[model samples]
Target: MARVKRCLGIDLGSHSVKLAEMALDGAGVRIIRMLAETLPVGPDATEEERNNATVNIIKGMMKKNRITTKHVVLCMPGQTVFVRRIRLPRATGSRLHQIILFEARQQIPFPLEKTIVEYQVFDTEKEREVEVLLVAMKRETNEEFMRLVRRIGLQPIGISITSLALFNGQDIQRINFKDISSKSGGGLSGLLGGKKTTKKKSKKDATGEGTSGEGVDAADQEVLADLGGVPAFEEVRAYVNIGARSTDVAVCKPGEGASVGFIRSIPLGGNHVTLAIQKACGLETFTQAETLKIEKTAVLSGSFEFEADKTLYDMDACQAATQICDKLISEVRRSLDYFISQPDGVGVDVVVLSGGSALLGYLAGYVEERIGVPVELSSALGNDQIKCATSYGDEFDYTSFKIAVGLAAQGLGIGRLSVDFLPADVRSMRDFSGQYVEFAALIGFIGAMVFFGSQIGAESEAKYKLTKEKCEGFTQKNTGGIERARLTALESKRSQIESKATVLSDFVTPRDYWLRFLSHVYQSKPARLLLTQVVCQPNYLGVTASGATTGGANSGAPGASSGTALPSSSDPRSGIVWIAGEAEQLNVINTFVSDLEQSKGASPNQRCVVKKATLFRYSSQAEKSEYFAPNPSIKFLIRVEVQDEEGCLLTRLDSQPFMEQTALPAAGAAGMMGGAENGGDPSAMGGDPFQEGRGGGRPRGGPGMGPGR
Candidate 1:
C-alpha cells in the first residue's frame, strides 16, 4: 500500500453511535477499526440523562478504538437537514450566490435567520441548465452537534449529511459504464435487464406489486433506469440508507460532474416494523416483540414455524410478522415512487441496502420482489476496497457500519458531495492560521534574497570605481579654458537649481489645503447632512461668529483693543471653515456640526474652534426633490476656525509662499465675505482665493478673470 493518512468518521444516530477509523491511500482504503455502541438510554430516562448516556457511550467507543487524532468528520442525521435539488439558467458571469439566496427564500419553509445553508454546483459544461444541490439545517441543530463534538476533545473538519457521505463510501463511481446497455434510454436498465419482470395492468401493479421476474410499467422501467444510470463520467442514482428510526432517500449522481438530484427522510425504519408486531401480536413488552421480529421473522417466505405447544399462536405470530414486513415494504415503495415522479426523474438500476435493520434475514430479497428491481446488501467495504487490521467475527454485522465508513471516507478527502457545514468562525480561524504561516515563510525568503544581493552590489561598485580612475587620467590631459568656462556655467546652473528646489520643497498649494479641509469636514460630518460649500473667513474683519469669540473680534485687529490677538490679519493665515449644508431634520445638521468640532483632523494642530452653528434658511418647496421633502426643513451653516495653541491666528510655512502673491484689496475681500454668507457660489466661498494676482497666481487679464480687467 502507498503512504496513507488516518481519518476518524463518526455517525450519531438516535439509538446507536457508529465510529470508524480508516487509513486511506491513493485509490485504496483500509479499515483501521470499526465499532458501534448502543445508546445507554433507559425507558424512563430524561432528556438530560439521555444526553449523558450518549456522551458516555461515545467516550467508551473512542477509548476502545484508541482514536487519538483530533481530525474528525461528523455526519449530520438526514432527518434534521433539508435537501433540495434545483436547476438554474446556464448563464455564466452572473452572481450565483445571489440567485441561490433568492431561490432559498422561496423554497425554505423557515426564516433565513434560523438556518445555515450550503450548496454544491454540478459542472454541466455546454448544457443549457445547471443543477445545484442545496442543503439547509437549523442553526441550533447544527450548533448542538458541534458543541457536543467539541466537548469530546475533537476538532470537526466538516459536517455533511449521512446520505451524501453514504454515496461517497460506496464504489458506485468505479463501475464500468460501457458494460451497461442503455436499451430503454434508462441509465440502469442494462444492468437490470437480464432478469426480465413484468407488471400487470392493475391498481396493485401501479402501487408496486411486481416480483423480481416480472416486467414493470414502461415508465417504471425508465424510472429505474434514471435511478441507477452510470452512462459516463457522471452517474445519477438513488440511495436508500435505512437506520433504526428513519430511512434516508438520496438520489446521487457521482463523477467529476456529478450532483445530488434530491434527498429526503421518511420516518419509517426497523423500529416501526417492531412496533407493528408488538401491536398486532398482543405482545406485553416492546423488547420481546423486537426479539421475535428480528429472530423469528423471515421476509423471503413471510412465515416461520413456531412451537408445537401453540400451533395456532405460531400462525398468528407469523401472520403478524408478515403484516409488519408488508407495511415497511409499502412505505419504501412509496418513497421510491416519489423519487421517480419528480422532475428529471431517473430509474433505479438496483437497490443497495445497508443498516442495522437490513440484517433482518431476507429483507433485501423481499424489497427486490416488491419493487421489481435487483436489491443487494452492502458491506463495510467493497471487494479489494479495504483491508482489515484484525479479522472481524462473522457474528458482527459489517453492513450496519456503512455510514461510519462513509463519514471516514469524507474526512479522508475522498467523498463526493464533500460540502462542509463547519461554522464560519472555525473556517476563518483555520484560513487565517494557514495564511500566517505562508506570510512568515515569504518574509524569510525575502530576507535571504536581500542579503545575497547586497554582497553582489558591493563587488560591482568596486569594479566601477577602478574603471572611472582609468578614464579620469585621459580626460585631465585634454582639459583647457573652453572646458573650464563650461564647468563654471554648470556650477552656476547647479546653485540656481538648488535654490529653486529649496523654495518649492516646503510649498503646499492652496488647492491641497482646500482638499484636506473638505475631506476632513465630510468624513466627520453625519450621513444625513448634505454639504454645499466651505467658506474660509479672514480674521481681519471684526466679526463675532456664533458660539465663539476670537480675541473679542477686534482685540488685535492691527489697531484694535488691548487684548486683540489676530496675529496674521494681512496674510491668508488660519481662518474660519464655514460648512454650508442641509438636512431633513434640524438635529441631524446640529449633530454634523458637533461631530466636526470633536474631530481631531478638523482641529489641525489642536487649534480648532467651533465659531458658528446656525440655521441659514428653511425651504418649504424645492426645485430639486432631494433638497426639500414633506414639510419645511432647515438648511444650516457651521463655522470652525483653526488657531495657534497660544490662542492667536497662525500662518504655516507652506502657505506663506502662496499668501504673499495673493493679497487682495480690502473692498474685494469685503465682496467675497458677503458672498460667503449668502451661499452665492462655491468658488466665491473657498476655491482659488488668489485667482487674480500679479505673479505665481492667475494674471488679472487671464482667461478666468471675468470678461474685462
Candidate 2:
C-alpha cells in the first residue's frame, strides 16, 4: 500500500462478483486482495436486468472505493460469446478480421448487426489448411458496458472472455472441448518442461514475432493466457472448466515450442442440471436447490453414491442426478463435437477439468470413457504451481474462483499466457437464460474488470541460466582478475534486470499479459469500491490542498476542484469545494455533493474516491463556454456538491464531515502520487491534476501501487 500502483480484476458471475487484486514484482505476479459480493435479483436473472444490475454494481463499487480506473480488463463467460473454427491458408493483417466478420454471420446464429467480432488463428494440418477461432458477442452488450462505465465513474479498458483467463492460467492451447479430462491426467507437464521452459517457440504470425503475441489473436501466433502447469505431454492439451452455469474448454498445442492457439467457449453449463433437478424436486428457491444439488452425489461427481444429507429423503438423489447427468452429457458431447469439427480437428492429447461443477470425482474418467478422450481433474488448487486457501464452507465455495485466478495469472504476467484485455463481445456460454439476466446487466456491472496475472516462483534454475554467461566470463575466489569479477557481477545485475524488465513490459502493454497476472493475484479481498456515477465535466476536475483532516469552505479531502470562485469564501467547507453543474454535468455534480451531504460514511470494507475529471462552467460575462447551454447558457449553474452514503448532498457545514479518507481515496488524487498517505495529497500544488483538468484520472485499481516490478 506504499504507492498507488495497483491493478484490479472483476468476474461478474451469475450469482456474484468475484474480484482479484494483484501486486506486481520484479519477476512475476502476486496476489494482494480477494473478494466476492452477491449480485441481487436471484439466480434465474435475465440479461436486461442482469446487464443493468451489473452496471449498477460496478458503479457502486467504483464510487465506494473511489476507483477511477480506466485500464480495466474485464472477464466474460465464454458460453455467452460465439466461437467458430475456420480454415485459412496463412496469416494476414486485417484480412483475418474481414473474413471472420463475414464468417461470423454464418457461424453465429445471431444476425451480423447484433454482434461485434474477433478471431484467433492456430497452426495448419494435413486436411485442414489452418484453423482460425472466431469469437463474437452481442453488440448491444458491448455498448451497454461502455455506456455503463461512462455512467458510473470509471472506464472499461478490456473485456475478455472468462474462459480465456482460465485457459491462460492453465496454459492450454487448441483444445477439443471434449478432452478436458485428459488434461487432468497430465497434459501441461510437457509444455512446462522445466523452470527454463521459456525457450521461444516457432509459432509465427505475418509479423514474424516469436509467436507469443496474444493481444490480438493472430494466425500461427500462440496465446499464453491459460492455467500454468508442468506440461503433461509434448503434443497438445485442454482445460475444461465445468462451471455452475457453463463449461469453458481450452486447448494448448505446442507447434515447435510454447505459444498460444485457437480458443473456444460454449454454453453447456451446470444450469442445465440445476434446472433439471429443480423440476425433478419441485424446488422453490435457487439457494436451497443449489445446496441440495451440490451436496448430493447424483449429478456432480458422475458417481451414483449417496451422501448422508437428510434432504435426499423424499426424492431419489441418485436418480435425479442421473436424469440431469444424461442431459448434461449430451450438451457436453455437442460442445466437444463442435470443437472437433474445426478444420484442424483439434488433436487434443489430454483434458483437465476444473471449476465448481468439476468437483465431481472421477468426472474426468467418465468423460474419457464416454468420449474416448483422456481426462483429468483439477480444482481451486491454485495455479498448477502454487496453492491458495480452501476456506469456504459447504455453503460457499471458492473453487468457483478458477477463472479469476487464471485471469490474475495472465494480468500479472505471472503464470502462463498473454491473453489479457479483450473486447466485451466474447461470450462464455451458449445460452444466458434466467430472470436475473435482466437485473444481471445492472447488478453485474462489476464484471467489466478482470485480473489475469501470475506470481513468479523462485526458479533458481532460471537465475543460474540468466547469469551463466557472466559467471563464465569472470574470475573467482579473490583471485587475479578483480576487474573481471566486478564486470561479471555487474553483468549479473544487468541480466536479472533485463529478464525482469521483459516480464514488466509484457505485463503493462499489449493487454493480455497484464490480465493473466490479475487472474492469479485477484481473489477475495473484500476491499472494494462502487462508483454509482461520474461526471467528467469541463471545470470539475482537480485536487486541492488539505491535511489528513479536511478544513475550510466546501473543502472535502484532497481530490476536489478549486471551484469557479465560490459564491462566498465564508462557506465553512470551502477553500475549494464543488457545486452542482448545469444540466447533465450539473446533475452529476449535485449528485456527488448530495452524497457527501447525506451522511453515514462507508463501512469497514469500503471507501469513497472523489476526483474531478473535468472543469465545468468557466463562462465569462463576455463569451460562451464550450459545454454551456446554447440559448439558456446554464442560467442556474448547478455547481459541484458532495453526497454521503445514502446519496444526500452535504452542506459547506457538516460535523461528521466527509474527511473519512481512510477506506476512500482522496478526491482527484492520481496514482499513489498525491500528498496524502500512501501516495500523496490529492490537492498539493503540482499534484492538482484537475486544476488543468486534462482527463478525469488514470486507471482506478486501488490507493497504493501493486508489488514492485
Which candidate gets the maximum lDDT versus the true structure? 1
RMSD in Å for candidate 2, one decimal?
30.4
Q: Estimate each model's TM-score.
A: 0.56, 0.45
Residue 336, model 2: Cα distance from true site in angstroms: 3.1
Cα lDDT listed for each candidate: 0.57, 0.45
Model 2 residue 672 distance off true place after TM-score fit, in angstroms: 99
Alpha-carbon deviation at 77 in model 1, angstroms: 1.2
Q: After superposition, how far is residue 24 of candidate 1 from its true place, in Å?
A: 1.7
Where does candidate 1 stray beyond 4 Å?
Answer: 1-4, 42-47, 89-102, 124-128, 172-238, 252-259, 277-288, 297-328, 393-396, 428-646, 649-709
Summarize candidate 1's per-residue lDDT along 1-709 as a digit string, tens digits. Answer: 0011567888887667888887654334567778888775533357567667777887777777666866677877788887777777643324656677789888899998998988765544334555667788899998887777777667666777888777766543343333332332333232222243343443212222110111233443332333234445333455677787788766654344345556677777777767767777788887777778766755535222222233323445556655666776787677667767876566667777888877766677667878787777875355443457666544456777777777776665445455667788875564464356688999999999999999999999999998999888766865775776798899999999999988876453333444455555667776655665555444533334432224332321222234344345333344555455556665676566567656544344433444334332223222232555554434444446643232323233433322211121111232332233445332433222222331112112101122110
Candidate 2 lDDT score relative to the true structure: 0.45
